[model samples]
Target chain A: MKYLLFLGCVIPYRISSYEISARKVLEKLSIELVEMPEFNCCGLPLDPVNHELMLTLATRNLCLAEQKGLDIMTLCPGCAGTLRKVNKALREDKKLKELVNGFMQEIDLEFRGGIVKVKHLVQVLAEDVGFKRMREAIQNPLTGLKVAEHNGCHVLRPAKYVGFDDPENPVILKKLIELTGALCLDYMYETECCGAPIIGVNDKIPLHLTGEKLRNVKAVGAQALITVCPFCHMMFDLNQPRIERVLSEKFGVPVLHYTQLLGLAMGFSPDELGLEQLRVKASKILNLN
Target chain B: MKNHDSTKPNSDGGQANDRKKEFGRTEHKIVLKASDLDPKFKYKISKIPGAERIMLCFQCGTCTADCPIAKFSETYRPRKLMRMTQLGMKDRVLSSDVIWLCAACFTCIDHCPQGVEIANVLRALRNLAAKEGLMPVVFKELVSNIRNTGYAYRIPELRLKRRAEKELPPLPKANLEDISKLFNLTHLSKTLEKEERQDA
Candidate 1:
């Protein structure tokens, strides 16, 4: 139950609650988490601009995990997707592995493929820590709270590489949410992109996309939006005010990391899960005045 | 015939007739020449990572139909971009802003009937565009941000202070020397350096 926790760039610096709550929940589940301080960006930002460079960067982290002889448990879906994609590419293509190793040699690290596995937090919870075990751990079931799950794009997409769940119709996140006794509301554009990818390049499009999803979630009478990835959390939680201003609509939906919800269900206080750090207040959903 | 006549007054032909009366000739014309095609463009795109399947697209338009960005945007069309790449319309594909407009959400990639990997192809086109100095200024700023710090957005002082107030562990500092070395070896730094020179 041990994993090399890969909290990619955003979670460490921007969205600390995701890491904080995930660690709290994983520790409670008896999952040992380790840190590799040398890990770099998951290479997602560079992927579109330079394919080989992105592979090399992602492989560098995989090699770090290989050195520790542990599978990676990633917090961000982008890191999960990039690392899994590179791991698959290197495993299938010996020549490409050697090519990447040639670059790694300069950095004094080598990636011997198949040494470790990369699992997203959702996979770690849904698969490694089963629902029955999680349900038994719940102390305060969120009986009537309506929450919408935003799985984000990379978590279940490019299915050949990231095979955690069905790409088109994912149920892992929903199943996990239901385990908390919360109503996982189904809404239009539930699986749509949160526009985090292009947020750096163009603000308007991503804002519009996030606004659309928020509008849909609000329309469905969900009090909160549940998220797993940090970037999606940023779009829905951190940039919520800006998104509202851009769309000229008020969506008071609170965005909570899945870990926060699980933490609350396990009887941990909102303070323990860093709930106050969120832009939108989760007080209403958590029943904490 | 009566309906056609009713629409004729509102059509371009009617406008052309008005222009002809005022200026002796029509002033606007669009022509596509066979010589505009560059046969090497597809080969060039195939060399990009994740775009090996660029030629597999059969123009099903599934990418466009499934695209969330295309739904709101009048100009952003993944299907059209795929066709342009397949037809070797190099300049059009590289120079147009639509290539940069793709959100890279991979919605089209997952839903493509032909499995074209349309989003990756758009990414390849973006890479080629950036290499050719066709990338937008804002993206270059992002590249420069990564070049300066290992992260895309700089960690603000207030966020660090807030993390402390929340009793969270401080973020570990990135090893910029290693990042810089990797950037140097990969020539990603070189790309940004070229951009700086262009600005100067």
Candidate 2:
């Protein structure tokens, strides 16, 4: 199956490893990724400041995907959530659609809202590439390697709109982790927000939240942590050392993008999956032969 | 407007004094005067999307309980904001630093039995506040980046050059004309203009 990949701002700007690894894994799974064109920031970053601008910008991207007639798959849950929420809103609300479309007229594009569907990477993998195929594709099961999953907030919260997995006890990512033959350990506050969105505004809180998750993951004897969203990955991996220093705790948990973990199971080397790009090194956990 | 004496509470009653004790400070003991409330602020916010269920909230602290930011932050309380909004505490709610602290994890929306999209309501409050030129500095920077580059942050030239060495595809170029027009149509351009003038 093929989908238009919406590589949202974060993945390109800071988290290229997620993009690189995901592309490799999806290619092996035979899922074609059509790169997005004329795409803006998915309108999520500025949603708080200007609601209409968010809608208009998301609508423009939706219209682009509608022209391609393929479902929009985003690596960033923020992009997937915003595009999906806006798509659903425009589909159900006529007056609101008209209001947003008025801005669309200036761009000379009108989106037939329901034509293009949106899904985050987790949803695409869990649904499109089923566990049966995934289990079969596992050349080297990561048995004995234990890791915890962080199901970034946007993927499952706001149960009314962007609903899929149980928001309270998310298991899709865990199940994905388990299929690689690695034991996915349970941890506290599994569904907690990474607090990445407000990093600049209040660095302390995100650090606390990230540090708490790392400690919890370490507490479970998990050697590493797995993430699906680049933002969450950044919080846990890129800022991990800083988080440890601030919290006065030392838990050297390597944060791997789910794609990187799956790529390892698919017989790809650490270098191929972009594991080397991680801030907190994964040298100890890359033991599957 | 300023009451220095916490012991000398005359009109609002002992509950106001008790409320002051909760904040742990004398100056933060703000009494809710009738003149300070708009009384129609809830209705105004109700007209905004995602905030349609604003009146359904019964001062439940579910939002604050489920909020991750609230766990570490002493001041950021979603339930208090919801109550304040319901009580028509417009100016105070808009000016609150806590409102900007919502990471929009949206756990509050899923957990709220009242079906109140608390995070969305907070965003609406922020959007209202932005109209009055009250967004945080980061938002100002983000607006500037999106206005100019169509990306939230300015991805450096070195990073763009590094993409090819890593065997990644070229990053999609943004349609600045359409983005700029949307910013203009949404009136975000004016907000940025106001923010820049203030900065200058």
Candidate 3:
């Protein structure tokens, strides 16, 4: 099936490998990712002030996908929640839908109800690329790798809207991690916020909180962490050094986007999955020889 | 007291006698000034959906008392910012670095007796400060970099190369035109310029 890939801001520049890995793995599952040209921020940031604006922005992007007659697939949980929220709201509220549709019409876009289905990468794999197909695709099973899952805050919270999973104790990432034949270890701070919000305001708190999480990941005897959210990956993988410096702690843990781990488990090589870009080197965890 | 010796000069090009006229200097006292918000300035707290309840804040100190980071760092105080915003002390409310200090953990917002969205307001104020160029130089530079480069997270090429020496893939760049466009669409820069012009 064809879907529009919304890379958002975090995935490409800071955590480019995530996009690469996600593409590689999804391609393996027989899914085609048509890149959207000129897609801007989903305006989730605007949700605080103008919820309508947030919906308007999301509608703009969704309408772009609707133009292509394709479904929407997002790697970022924030984008997913924002898109799903807008999609559901517009589909349900006819007046609100009319207003947003009018706004879209001004920009030459239309939001026909249910024109697109926004699916997180994890859901795509488990549902579209089912466990049976995943099993068939695995060439080199991650034999003894102990993995911990950090599902990210946006994936769960504000549950009344997103409704992705049990907001308090999410197991989707854990289930995805186990599909790779890796031992999944339970760890505290699994569902905790990685402090992505405060990164703009105060870098110290996010650094400290993420550091505590990394320490917990290590304490759980996990070889690496599997995450679905790019923001979480940016905080856990890209900003790991900053966190280490601030906390005066050492947790040389490697973080993998769920797709990257799935790609690795499915017999994809390190280079193919683009595992080289991570700040926390993956060789220590991956059998990349 | 008058100086008995005037043979040496002081650092200020005066007499050294004035610096230490006598061994006992109890008569001299250091004076400290108590500062208050600028009298002419007032901050109007813009309405944020979830944070609208922030208006009910009565300076109860509950937010300050329940804050986690507040225990260690005094830079952030939700109660104080809420009070300041309610009083229309715009400059003090928006200019203070305290607003940017929120971790956005929702602890304060969740536990607030008045259902105040302390974290959300802090986010808005910080966004305002960023738009106004009131943010710290480093943060402003980072935001500028993100605007131009499309990525907020930084990884030096040298470090990426060094890390890649272990057979890791080169760091991929995230697409950031989306963010730049968002900032532009919000007229964030224009609003900031207007505020700066007004302040000047």
Q: Pick the candidate with the highest lDDT.
A: 2
lDDT of candidates 1 onward, in order: 0.80, 0.86, 0.66
* Quality of candidate 2 docking, DockQ: 0.51
TM-score ranking from best to worst?
Answer: 2, 1, 3
- Greater-lDDT candidate between 1 and 3: 1
Which lDDT value does model 1 have at A58?
A: 88
Cα lDDT tens digits for candidate 1, A106-150: 888899888998988998888888988889989988888888999
lDDT per residue (tens digit) for residues A188-244 in model 3: 756667777556545666677678788989998998988888888888888888888
Going through the candidates in order, the fraction of native interface contacts each one reproduces equals 0.42, 0.87, 0.15
Q: Considering summed lDDT, which 10 consecutive residues are worst modelled in model 1 chain A? A: A196-205
Question: Residues A160-227, candidate 2, lDDT per residue (tens digit)?
Answer: 78778888888888999999989998999878989999886778889998898888899989998999
lDDT of 2 at B177: 90
i-RMS for every candidate (Å) is 6.5, 4.2, 9.8
**C-alpha RMSD of each candidate structure in angstroms:** 6.5, 4.6, 10.0
Ranking by lDDT: 2, 1, 3
